[model samples]
Target chain A: MVTMQNYDNIEYLSETIRVCIKRRFGDDCEIANIALATLGGSNRTVLFNVVRGSYPLRLVLRQETVPSEYSPFLPSDMQYRVLEVVYEHGIPVPRPLFELEAADNLGQGYVVTAVPGETLPKRLINSAEYVTMRARFLQQSAEILAKLHTIDHVLVPGLSALQESSDPLGAQIALYDRYGEPHPAIEFAFRYLAKYEPEHGAKNFLHGDFRNGNMIVGTEGIRVLLDWECAHTGSVMEEIGWFCARSWRFGRVDLAAGGFGDRETFYRAYEKASGNLVDRESSRWWEIFGVMRWAIYNIMQSHGHLSRERRSPAFAACGRNTGIIEYDLLKIIAKEFD
Target chain B: MIWSARMFNDPPNASELLLTVREYIEQLLPDLERQDKYHGLCCTYLLDVVMRELEEPPNIGDHSNNALKALLNNKDELSETEFMSSLCASIRRGDQDGNLDRLLILLTSHVSKKVRVSNPDYLDTKDYL
Candidate 1:
């Protein structure tokens, strides 16, 4: 509901947001410290301090950005609904407050209580403050993902069975084709995957972008899992593979589990949590698929910059990262073959 | 002065110039904040890649074609790009199902060549294979 005129001014938007909060929490609520949150690339997140009566609250307002070709087709409302369901199910997600009303004159999105922690992967891995948690990071992450996968898909509104469940390799090829440019390396990976398609497993909730950078970590452990926009119904192994993907390791290829621990430690923790045996072969296949997916996404990000859909030096650098991902993909596949 | 057409050998080659710029940016990176720092780091990395490309351009085409030729066991008039595209198509069509090993070898060789140019460090650290 953001009008064209007031949309560009943060101060005006803050006052308007104050009015909306006043409507919800009565006129006793006061909003202040309206500042932008740093990490979200696809959405605009605003952090604000809310004083309601005698209590103070830290909250986040996530507003959907203008959709581009790269934006996931899933609605922002769907994400909010998913967050609500996940939080209800004891998941470590920010507590969902409420979705914005059209009458509020703010753009589409919702409000949630902000989790107190950091999401920066470099800091999480290297900072002295997080040293105590690093040893248990892999097991903690695995446990969270295992719990997430156990959530009944029927419980989440707007959640649908993944099309990839039927033909995992073909779906990726089709997606790449949709991008309208032929990448010989990616095409080669696709063919390789198709030729050696892994045995299908039971479908579950796949946290499509599960990685260290998306998790908010504190001294205790993982505070909350963030970025649920890519959530979908697929193989549980898909989430595992994605979490262990080389790119997610953040340059520490030595530590397989998001640069925190070895693959066995992560797999063992997940198996223990979910009561499901880990299929090493199938998991490895999905790992390769994860790398390829990341490579394709890097290209898409670069294309966004190159095509002027979004002009960012980071996107251009992401395009170059496709090479490193391809290198890892080849290395992993070759090692598997041997 | 002899009137002869010739290409000049420049003192500051493309790689050298890119390295200089990358170094300068790397020095200034400490001053940047938040988004600017992130973008500055990316720019520095991009320059590094461009420098690497100039110094050691990948010949993946030749490596891929050679591998493909061996796998197909036939010498044809198809260009390298055409052959690669056709190979991908054939694999997609399940024509290579019977020869998965050969396909793996070809792909590994091609991708390895690319890695050599894109990031030789990957090859150096990856001793698993």
Candidate 2:
């Protein structure tokens, strides 16, 4: 992991500004401190808190490429730009403040956006403040999600550059195929998603990872969709399904939508806001896909540790859980499908 | 009776042993892609670990698969659901550290005889990996 000190170079900060922000905002701002968040992601998020007198400014800094010592797949500038476009459509994200290439004002590539709410996964919905406002959270989240999917898939931009498969079912099955073995756990999920593929008929917006972890849970129970890096154009059910995925329940499995409330509550909220029918069966199909998708993501991060360049036991030890996830999926599949 | 290589000086996290033990062989990734077949399995191993770790008490799974061994013992008697349910109940019953230590010890015994050789009669809650 590149330490925070390494990023404190004054020359680099000036260069980063020149390339991405200064061209737009000019050089009147002064950086107060450079800080990093070492959290659940593979990127180095250096926050530049600049002193613009009374009105302080915060810029989120991430590099297109990171040293080999870190995870190699830190999203590139291209990936960051794609996310910016997603944010532009008002996707409950910190609007893309700036995008830059190497220049004297900023080092390498940098992008900055005002920080959103504190990124808290564990406390958000569980906090007493969210209980009474629970229904609003679900309704607003589904409404925002509906808007995200309703956007013209073509205009969303960066679809081709991101990962895609021949068809929705094919993409899902191929994902499972990558992990061989007829283990009852994975097979159960595989059969269900394949057998009962959501017949949504037309593709729509998909927030590939929409759950408690990605969302910002706040006062109004508002869930600002975060992390468009994994966003894709797919069945609208895909996003909803992810919201209700078992893994995302975070122990409160009873409240399906990020464990905040039940499916009826979520469904009513979504349908009322989006003016769409609740596709219960299709949601089930996507929910199954959500678990599989999460499993794949987990395995990939764990696997990356093996590369000498990015070797960290912390990463590698995480790899040993496919079977367990598969086990959960299989049980769910058997219970519902068989 | 044996001291070799950098012994106690090593901070456990940064050791070469870390590289070998963790399944993510990103270094070996290139080799597997070239060899052509096992690459998928190799990759799957790492992904499983990453996803689970991201969830909670992350390191619990890999070092000790011993928690549910009793379920495995009655493999003939236990259906998949029954086994899983029982194990899940057992895991939820107490402190995670105690459970993890017990499981790790069991795994150490099963995977290697070194623990047995060093202390055959050792059996106590206090012992830890």
A276: Cα error in model 1, Å: 2.3
Q: What is the TM-score of chain A alone in each candidate?
A: 0.90, 0.80
Docking class of 2: incorrect
lDDT per residue as tens, model 2, A1-338: 33333345545644554345555665776665665443243454566666656887887766532343332132555456656666778777765655554443333444556555634554665767666766776777778877776776666455633444126555554544443322323433444465566466666756667777676656755635555555566677778888998887655767878777898889888888788887898887778787876666556555555544234444453454454444345445545311
Cα RMSD to the true fold for all candidates: 4.7, 13.3
Chain B TM-score of candidate number 2? 0.23
lDDT of 2: 0.55
Looking at candidate 2, what is the lDDT of residue A178? 48
Q: Which docking class does model 1 fall in?
A: acceptable
TM-score of B-chain for each predicted structure, in order: 0.75, 0.23
Model-by-model DockQ, in order: 0.39, 0.04
Error of 1 at B127 (Å): 12
> Over 4 Å off in model 2, which ranges?
A1-27, A38-42, A64-88, A104-110, A158-166, A172-188, A308-314, A336-338, B1-129
Expressed as tens digits, the lDDT of each residue in A146-188 for candidate 1 is 8888888777655664445455666566666666654556766
Structure candidate 1, residue pairs in collision: none
